[model samples]
Target chain A: MAILELKDIHKSFQDNVVLDGINLSVNKGDIVGIVGPSGTGKSTLLRSINLLERPEQGEIRFEDITLNLPLKGKERKSVTALRKRIGMVFQKFYLFEHKTALQNVMEGLITVQKKPKKETEQIALDALEKVGLKAWKNHYPKHMSGGQQPRVAIARTLAMKPDIILLDEPTSALDPELVTEVLTTIKAIAEQGYTMLLVSHEMDFVSKISNRVLFLDGGKIIEDGTPEEVFRHPKSDRAKEFFDKMNKLKEPEFFI
Target chain B: MDTKFSDYFSVKLMWSRIPYLVKKIPITLELAGLAFLVSIVIGLLIAVIRYKKVKILSPIATAFLSLMRGTPMLIQLYVAYYGIPAILRIFNSWGANIDVNVIPKMVYAFFALGLYQAAFTSETFRAALESVDKGEIEAATAMGMTYGQVLRRIIVPEALENALPGICNSVIGLVKGTSLASTCGIIEITYQNQILAGRDYRYLEGYVALAIIYWIITIILEKIFKLVEKKFRIPEQPKTVEEV
Candidate 1:
C-alpha cells in the first residue's frame, strides 16, 4: 500500500507553469530519488508534497490526512502538525548559527515536540553519534567544516524521528571530500529502511541509495523504475537525452 | 557675558566644591536608565509593526517615526512638560475635574526622551531584522515551526545580536540626553551644578566637574556594552584538532 501519494499535482508561478499534472506514490520504507536537469521543477514537486510550495491543485495523502492547500490559518496549523512527522534537509545546511550541534538537534524536540530537556539531550547526542558528530555536538555551525555542518543538520532532522525525510541536494554545496561523509550518512539512513524522497544531482549516490529512481522533465515525471532500469535502459527520449548530457560531465571520484 | 569666577578663582576651592556636583549623578543615571528601557520596548514594537507591514498600523508607525524624528527633542520635551498641562486645563474647565499638573516633571522628561530614542532605535531594529539570511527563516519554517516560533527562535535572536552596537550607541546618546532633563526642573547633575556656580561664582569649576561626571558615565557604559556584545557574539569558525 502507498504510504504517501500525490495525485494530479499542478503548480505554476505567474503564467509560467513550473509543474504540470504530476503523480507519484511511495510505499513505506521506499527511498525515491528524483533526478533531472536544472529548472525541471523537481524541487518544486518535492516541496509541493510537504506544502512548502503550495500546488495550484492537487490532493496529497500522507498516512491518513489529505493536505488542504492555498493554506489558511487552520489549514496552515494542520500542515505544520503534519510537517512534524515529515522532515526536510536543505541543500544549504541551515544549522542555526547561534546554536551548537547538540543544541541545534535539540531545538525542535524542545520547542515543537515539547520533549523533556534531559531526554532531548540524550536523543540529540545519539543522533549526533549516528552522523559521526558526537565529538562535535557542542560546536557551532560556523566553526565546523561545510561537510560536518550538514551532518549536524541531518542529526537535527533525524532526532525528530519523523516518518519520512525529504532531502534537497543534501551534499550539492559540499567540497569533494566532504560529500563522501554526507553521502555515507544518507546511505546509512537508507539502510535503516526509513522513507525518503531525495532530489539530487549526484546520480551515482542516488542510484546506489534509491530503491527506485524517477526522472522528471519539464514539470512531469518522464520515467520511473528501479535504479538499474532508469539508468541502464531509459525508454523515454527526454530521459535518454538527460542521461547522455549528465554522462559527458566529469564526475567526482566517489561516483565510481 | 561677564565672567562670574574672576573674584573666586581659587583652584583649591574649585577642587573641594567638585564633590557637591558629583552627588547628583544618581538622578541623572536614573532618568537615562529608565528612559532607555522604555525606549527599547517601544522601539521593538514600532519595528515589528513596520517590518510586518500590518495594513492599518504600519502607516501609523511610519507617520509616528517621521513625526518623532522630524521635531527637535527640546521642543518635544517642552510640549510634553508645558503644553500638556495647558491642554488639560482647557479640558478641565469643560467639566472634567482632572488635575493637569499632578504628574511630575521628571515623568514628562522621561516620556520625551524615550519617544525620541524609539524613533532612532526603530530604524536600527528594522535594518538588523532585514539583514538575517532569508534561507535561515525558510529552513526554520520547513522544520514545522509556527511563524511565531520561527521569529522567537530564529529571527529575533539573530537580529538582536546584529542590532547591539547600534542600540548601545543609542543608549549612550540617551545618557547624554539626560542632561536636558534640567530644563524640566529635575535638579539632576547639570541643574545642581548651575545652582552651585550661582552661589560661589565658580562657574568654570562647576562646569568642569559636570563634564568629568558625564565623561566617566560614558566610559563605564561603553565598557559594559562591550562586554555584552562579546557575550552574544557568534563563535568564530571551529578550529579542528586532529583526533588520533
Candidate 2:
C-alpha cells in the first residue's frame, strides 16, 4: 500500500515552473533514488513533500490525512503536523552551531515532541550511537569533521522518527575525502529498512542502495522503474543521454 | 608670564577627591544599570519588530529608530527630563492620578539613555539575528519546530552570542552617558567631582580625576566583556586554505 501519494503537484517561481504537474507514490519501506541534472527540480520536489517549498497546487495523501496544497490558514496546523512525519536532511548538514551533537539531536525531541528530558537524552544518545558518533556527542559541529557533522545531522533527523526521510544530495557539500564516511553512514541507515527518498548525484551509490530509480528532467519524471531498468535499460532518450554522460564522466580520461 | 605648571595641576587635591568621587560611583552605576536593563528589553523588541517587518509596528519602530538616531543625545535628555513631565501634567490635569513632581530625575535619565542606546543596540541585535544561518532555521522548521520554537532555540541563542561585542560597546557608551544625568541634578560621579572642584577651584584636577575614573571603568568593562566573549565563544571551523 502507498504510504504517501502526491497528485498533480505544480510549483512555479513566477514564470519559471519548477515542478510541472508531477505525480508520485511512495510505498512503505521503499528506497527511491532521484537523479537529474542540476536545476531540474529534484530538490524542490523533495522539499514540497514536507511543505518546505509550498507548491502552487497539489493534493498530498499521507497515510490517512489529506492536505490540499496552497494551504489555507486553518490547514497550516496540519502542515506542521505533516512535517513532523516527514524528515528532511539538507546537503549542507545545517547542524545548530550553538548546540552539541547530542543537543542537536535532542532539540526536536524535547521542543517538538515534548519528550521528557531524561528519556530524550537516552533517545538522542542512541541515535548518535547509530550514526557511530556516541563518543562525540558533546562536540559541536565546527569541532567535528565535515563527515562527522552530517552524521550528527542524520542523528538529528533520525531522533524525530519521521515516517519517511528525505535526503537531498546529502554528501554534495562534503570534501572528496569526507564523502565516503557520510555515504557509509547513510547506507547503514538505509539497511535498517527506513522509507527514504534520496536525491543524489552519486550515481553508483544510488544504484547500489535504491530499489527504485527516478530520472527527472525539466521538472518531470522522465523514467521511474527498478534501478537496473533505469540504469541499464533507460526507456527515454533523456535518461539514456544522462546516463551516457554520467558513464563518460567516470572515464579517467574525462578528468584529464 | 612665568606661570608654573603647578598653578594648573593639583595632584594632591586630585588624590584627595578620589574617595569622595568614588562614593558617588553607586549612583552612576544605578543609572547605567537601570538604563542597560531597559535597553536590552526595548532593543530586542524593536529588533524583532523591524527584523520581522511586523506590519503596523514596524513603521512605528522605524520612525522611532530614525528619531533616536537623528537627534543629539543632549536634546533627547532634555526631552525626557522636561518634555515627559509636561506631557504627564496634561494627563494629570485630566485626573490621571500621576504626580509629576514626585517622579524621580533618575527615571527620566533612564528613559532617555535607555531609548537612545536601544536604538543602536536594536541595529546591532538585528544584524546579529540576521547573521544566524538561514539553513539552521530551515533545519529546525523541517524537524517540525514552530516559528516561536525556531526563534527561541535556534535564532536567539546564536544572535545573543553574536551580539556580545556590540552589546559590550553599548554598555561602555551608556556608562559614559550617565555623566549627562548631572544636567538634571542627579549628583552622580561627575556632579560630585564638580562640587569638589567648585570648593577648591581646581577644575583641571577634578576633570582629570573624572577622566581617570571613567578610563578605569572602561578598562574594567572591556576586561569583563573579553572574559564573557571567551566563555561563550563558539568554536569556528578553521578557514579553508582557499579562504585564507
Candidate 3:
C-alpha cells in the first residue's frame, strides 16, 4: 500500500532546478534508499516531502491529508500536522547543543506534542534505550562521540513516533571510523519495522538495510526498484557509471 | 619650589574618605543593577525585532541602534534628563496630565544607560541568535515545533549560552557607564568622591580612591562571571576521531 505519494514535485533555486518534476510513492515499512551523487537533489526531495524546501509545484498525499505545494496560510496548519507524521534526521545530527540527550528527546514531546512531563520522560528514556544510549542520556551532544550524537538524534525522532522517518545522509558527517555505530543503530531501527527514506553515500550499508532503492540523477529518479534489481542491474548508463565508481572507491588500494 | 608627592596625593586623606565613599557603593550598584535589568529586557526585544526582520519595527530598531551607538553615553544621559521633560511639557501643553517633576534623576539615568547599553547588547544578542546552527533550527521545525516554540526552546537557550560572555562584557561596561549618571545629579560613588574632594581640594586622593573602588568591583564581577561561565559551559567537542 502506498502510504505516501508525491505527484509532479518541482523545485528550483533561482535558475537552478534542483528537483524537476519528480514523482514517487512510498509503501508502509519500505526502507527506500535514495542514492545519488552530491548536489543531485536527493536531500531536496526528502526535505520537500516535509515542506522544508517549499516545492514550487507539487501535491502530497499522506493518510487523510493532501497538501498542495507553495502552502497558503490556511494550509500551514496541515504542514505542522504533516511534519508530525514525517520526521527527518539531518546529516549534522543537529542536537540542541544546550540540552542533554534525554532533554533533546523530551523537547518535542513536551513542546509540540504537549505531553505530560512524567510520561514524556519515560518515553524519552525508552527511546534512548532503543538507540543503546540509555546510560548516556544525561550527556550533552558535545560530550558524546560523533557516532553517539547521531544516535541521540535518531532517538529524538523515534520518540516522536512519526509515520515515516527521513534520514538524510545520517552518517555522512561522521569520521570513517565512527560511521559504523550510527549505521548499526539505524539498522536496528529498520528491523523494528519503521518506514524510512534514507539518502546515503554508504552504498553497502544502504543495500544491506533498504528493501527498495531509488537512483536519483539530475533532479529525477532515474531508477526505482528492489535493492537486488537496482543494485545489480541498473538500467540507465548514469546509474551504471555511478555504481561502478562507488564500487571502485570501496576496494582497498595500495601503493608500493 | 619642590612639592612632595604626598602633597598631591595624601594617603591619609584617601584613608579617611574610604568610609564615606563606601556608603555610596549601594547606590552605584543599585543604578547599575536597575539599568542592567532594563537593558536586558529592551536589548532582547530589539534583537528579536532585528533578527526576525519584523516588518514595521525592524527599521525603527535599526535607526534606534544607530542613534544610540553613534552618540556618546553622556549625550544620551543629557537627552534623557533634559529631553524627557521637554517632551512631557509638550504633552502637558496638549492637556495631558503628567507630573514631570516627580520623575527622579535616577530614573533618567536608568533610562539613558539602559537605552545606551541595549544598543550594544542587541548586537551581541543578534549575533548570538544567528550563531545557532540553521540545521538545529530545521531539526526543531521538522519535529513540528512552531516558530515561537523553536525560538523559545531551541534558539533562545542556545543563544543565551553563546551570549553570556558578551553579556558579561556589556554589564562591566554598563557598570563603568553608571559613573556618567553623576552628570545628571544622581549621587553615586563618583559624585560622593567629588563631594569629598571638594571639601579640601584633595582631588588626587579622591580620584585614586574612586579608581581603587571601581577596580575592585570590576575584579569581583569578573570572578562572578567566570564562575557562571564555568557552571553553564558546554563541553568542547573532540576535534579528531582519535580523541573521540
DockQ of 2: 0.41
Pairs that clash in candidate 3: none
lDDT for each residue of candidate 3 in A59-176, tens digit (9 for 90 to 100): 9999889988878889999998999888889999899988888899999999989999999999999999899888887788888988899999999999999999999999998888
The DockQ-based CAPRI class assigned to model 1 is: medium
Better of 1 and 2 by DockQ: 1
Backbone-clash count (model 1): 2
Evaluate chain B of model 3: give its TM-score: 0.93
Q: How far is A231's C-alpha from truth in model 3 (Å)?
A: 2.3
Interface RMSD of each: 2.6, 7.7, 5.5
Worst 10 residues of 1 chain A by lDDT: A68-77
Between the candidate structures 1 and 3, which one is better when assessed by TM-score?
A: 1
Per-prediction share of native contacts kept: 0.58, 0.64, 0.67
For all candidates in order, the CA lDDT equals: 0.88, 0.92, 0.91
Q: Lowest-lDDT window of 10 residues in candidate 2 chain A?
A: A247-256
lDDT digits (tens) for residues A1-256 of candidate 2: 8999999999999999999989999999999999989999999999999888999998998897789988888989888898888888998989998888889999999999999999999999899989988888777788888889989999999999999999999999988888898899899999999999999999999999999999999999989999999999999998899889888877788444
Docking class of 3: acceptable
Model 1 regions more than 4 Å off: A250-256, B1-14, B237-244
Among the candidates, what TM-score does chain A have in each? Answer: 0.95, 0.97, 0.97
